[model samples]
Target: MTSKKSPVGGHIPVAGGMATKGLKYAAEIGAEAVQVFVSNPRGWAQAAGKPAEDAAMRESGVPTFVHAPYLVNFGSPTPETLERSVASVRHSLQRGAAIGALGVVVHTGSAVTQPFDDAMRQVREHVLPLLDELPNDAPDILLEPMAGQGAMLCATVDQLGPFFEHLENHPKLGVCLDTCHAFCAGHDLAAPDGVQKTLDLLVETVGPGRLKLVHANDSKDPCGSFKDRHENIGAGQIGEKPFAELFRHPEVAGVPFIIETPGRSADPHRKDVETLKRLRDNA
Candidate 1:
């Protein structure tokens, strides 16, 4: 793929029940990229996609990313949940390919009641087979590290190495860094050099090449609070200054920074996108 500076965008709802509408909404808000759910985020059911809509999205020239269902938990203790999680990922990748998505983001899920070792074993046993099944042209499966809530698998940036090791460092595996989650998990993005330190840590741990997508949201809670609530850019605990640092980080250049903040309407998201673009341009 031809690379430029980093792309700034947001997660917009499918306007009027059409994926094309969502793409249009993203453009209306001056987004350079976009993220969308191919199916119900909270459900296991994968929706059938239309080729026309996929073609339209591809024709729109906006870089796209697909977020896998929230129900996916590859580390689940139950066999059925594990099976469904694998299936969901496969389905999401298939849809992502159809829409020419750069990556498909899935949460690095919790181990729940199981021991962390057992969860890693489950991830190896179940997730490896699914990875093996992917086509050569399939989009990268971007593992998003979660806030340090409950028994989350990749609770911090440093913990991602183990997850990649469990998968044998597959090329199809990558990372999606969420600013709010990173702060909530104790990376402290509000500090002057915090965004740089976090990006440097990520580059140190995963390498700059493996860093694929970014969820650029401010945190509603304090640093190390472990809450996952996402506030709009510049309006929460993360403030606005650090995002300039994020924009200036050399490692983050060409990565897609997607905002998953509050407000369902286009107006709020438009402002957020503008804010990020301004930061990026002036950085």
Candidate 2:
């Protein structure tokens, strides 16, 4: 059964209601796991979850994830931005807990015109408290590495080393690797042995069990392009083959693969989910 296996799903839109819109869309796409944004993805607004919607999500019995607002930049050089980022993350963790989420995915934001060392210093100061403050059963703060664009804090698997070190490798901190990001960061997941090599490095860098989620998407740009555009599975630069390798990789055995591929229509997401399921089952 898919429940006992690594589930494949997509980032379901939660605009109307978590259950009525988000969960309903998930079912239509045959998603075994789901990810949703609890607030405006591109805004700093911190919105609370509706009790009924939260309860409905909990009762759905599907693995769930919460994506923190896209504008959350913990490494921002500005004081106001940093303060709001910290508050936003705390809010996301609370919302994730309310909905029985497996993790809260936050972008490993940029240094943004600051020295890398100084930026990481800010990250430690702002992020450590939140990690330390999680309840025992609270969802992990999963760091989704960026596409190596601009001044990303953690893009390549190796770069995660310093990020984890600064946070002292807190137990509550986990990783959410995005294929497009890794490819853009030059992991070469499209190569014959690229997926395996990248997974190997990730396991080595973070140690086992820290990779909690995977964003399964193809890239619109070629490897090392530093672009974040996502394409449908097998329909772009990172071909279908690497995903098969990913499915068989021991490091990701039980991790959920959530697609952030292009298209809001259920049809595209369903096809992507079904394609991943085939690769997963065959592997």
- Scored by lDDT, the top model is 2
Give per-residue CA lDDT, model 1, range 177-224, as digits (tens). 999999999998888789878989888888768989989999889999
Candidate 1 wrongly placed segments (more than 4 Å): 1-3, 15-17
Query: What lDDT would each prediction earn against the true structure?
Result: 0.87, 0.91
lDDT of 2 by residue, 191-259 (tens): 999988998999899899899999999999999999999999999999899998898888887899999
As a TM-score, model 2 comes out at 0.98
Best by TM-score: 2
Which residue pairs clash within candidate 1?
A: none
**What is the Å distance of residue 237 in model 2 from its true position?**
0.3
For candidate 2, the lDDT comes to 0.91
Number of backbone clashes in candidate 1: 0
What count of clashes does model 2 give? Answer: 0
